[model samples]
Target chain A: MEDFSIIKQQDEILREIEERQPMFTPVQDFSSLEVEYASNPPFQAKIPYLQSKYSGFRRTRGDGNCFYRSFIFSLFEQLIQNKSHLSNPDSPYSQIYSAIKQKVLDSGDILNAAGFLPICYEDFIDMISAKLEMIPTTEISQLEDDFKDKIIADTYVMYTRFIVSAFLRLHADEYSGFVEGYPDIVSFCNSEVDPMNRECEQLQIIAMTEAFQIKAEIEYMDRNDRTETTLMSFPFEYTGPDFKIHMLYRPGHYDILYPNRS
Target chain B: MATRTRLLRELKGKTEEFSLNNVGDDLMIWQAIIQGPSDSPYADGKFTIEFRVPENYPFAPPKARFITRIFHPNVHFDTGDICLDVLKSDWSPAWSLEALCRAIVALLSAPNADSPLNCDAGNMIRAGDMRAYNSMARMYTIEFAQERNLN
Candidate 1:
């Protein structure tokens, strides 16, 4: 009887641990996204907005980290597309690495000037920046290896999350001035933006787009609205490049979307 | 994976207040000594924490525990295990080792007894027994943490 009770208690503890784990991994592979759009007609109607902008999108996990994962995936693929546009067929991965290296450095510079403590994220950024430079292979073949390894791909996602977190923390006064209910910076960061696995909302979206200087469009498909999808661009009023990433936000989740130019 | 890089940076960035080094070339196992804040009951205390990083680091949080006994609400007194939210589900890849050490110091200064691992310490705080809690914490620091300061 005693043994049975102890085993039952152990099962309960295991179940709780499993529940605490994320429903999905940091990143997942791409799949045909049309099936997803086709299933929801209301959502399908909004695809034209995306169709005018993007080619296709890769699906990320439903986990809260999807925003970070999907954002990095789109950022790199965009660089790859531009690099490959020359028809050189030579691997664009080297250029992609350089582009990422540049972006992180740029963000780091901005954060540093804003009085953000680099020590908080110095190693996190360095490791990611080093990954691009340290691969030892300036060749495209090495990028193929990077793609196959799940940890490498996920590392990019982790780095992106760090970038956003640092930006939001450093520039709290500039951004959080309008935000309601946070008495101070740490509380605001801790509750709304800093911690891992907290689903990002408007504040995070703005901070990331402004910090990275990447224009982005987030289209919302609501459970209540059957006819129209709300398509709004980020950073409230940043008028920059006409072309940028288009993301599909369906209540609690985000995914990349592309134009079907073909 | 990036733990060593951050540790080195932390060392350079903060010349004092922290002493972090790997036990060996393993890089995965590190010993950290955090200087308690001057204003706290644990002031002048040098607390030792062991950081155990997993193979898939940056993706996972290091398991940090005090090797020195600490009479605090968030720290498990006997095992020295901490109940910091950031060390668990709240961990983000953005946090560096230096950030963690600073957080540990902050934890020592202002412990959150609301959700504590050390029931006795938590209860004392909740019961508004500040005088007793301070004396007890100071005693632990004197016994376990002050020796490093003296040295």
Candidate 2:
């Protein structure tokens, strides 16, 4: 009788393990994730190892709370599609990434995509909860969970918005003129002010403008008219109180747009 | 499907001169030419740029660089290192190649003297002396772009 019960218990445990194994399986090939990411350009270059790990997660498990694995896979795909355009060390993407990184002090979403956030968040929550022994308040416990959730939500939203805006802005000039019934490229240029955070407002404007440029580019490309190439040589320029941008574009194996005079 | 669709959109919307090239099964590269902004030192200049996107894009920022040498305080003289905030920690998934190109154009018009990748050039700009800055910039542009007839 005892032996039978032990066997039964073991079988139950095995079944449970089998059921949960898929969720725990690590992500393997991030290359498979290139599709969504390719749709939008990434904010930074990914490390290969990190990319592989993130891809593996997406392959095995669907979506974790952080969705970091999914994000990584998408970003990798975008990089692959745009690799030729990014060959130049001074390309616009590189410059913008450098510029944004320098300005933004904290970007949790980026950290998460790099595969550092999920585990960190878990550990952080664990540590804080452990401190409950000292203060032992139900309110505190509830507050901690709420705070963590808010942070996660904010991070995810901010990251997504930034990526979308950046993509649109980068291609605005190329696609703007071609978008039928779309707002004129010049009309899209407007100052945005944020009362909550002045710097955030500025960043948002920059992002919006960048998105506009990308939209314009995409619209132009869609026309498929040979005449579209005629506009290829037009330079994109930006004038802000703090900075002035003068960019040049050319055609070849890769799109070449560089700062200064290229 | 999403990636292909987006690429198609970008390609169709792009001016005919811009083309996307596949580097590997998982990498795609793009090439484009930009005209110099009017009234700037780079005016009438034709510049080329390259963008490299990895498979794990959007999460990781794409790598970009200038194919031709450029003269600017914010850009590295020898390495073409650019001082831009978005490429680093601030990178958001929303940024695209076109937006980046515009930013580069903007950077040329407004060189960031506050954060100088090229110390000498930055100093000249900060010193409030346009003479030295403009001269060196013009000389560098001529050497890299005009002499080579990149435009």
Which candidate has the top score in DockQ? 1
Residue A162, model 1, lDDT: 57
Off by over 4 Å in 1: A1-56, A84-103, A114-150, A169-171, A178-181, A190-192, B1-14, B36-38, B148-151
lDDT tens readout by residue for model 2, A77-196 = 223333444445466544433343332323344334433323222222333224322222334234324323423323333343433333334456764664344374322321111000
For A6-119, candidate 1 gives per-residue lDDT tens digits of 545855764574466432332222233346666866666665555555555555555466787667656655554554332333444444445456887776776566445677
Instruction: Give lDDT per model, in order.
Output: 0.67, 0.43
What root-mean-square deviation over C-alphas does model 2 reach?
27.1
**Native contacts matched by each model:** 0.46, 0.03
Per-candidate TM-score, chain A: 0.65, 0.22
For model 1, name the residue pairs that clash.
Answer: A54-A258, A54-A259, A55-A258, A55-A259
DockQ (C-alpha) of model 2? 0.02
Best by lDDT: 1
Model 1's TM-score against the true structure: 0.75
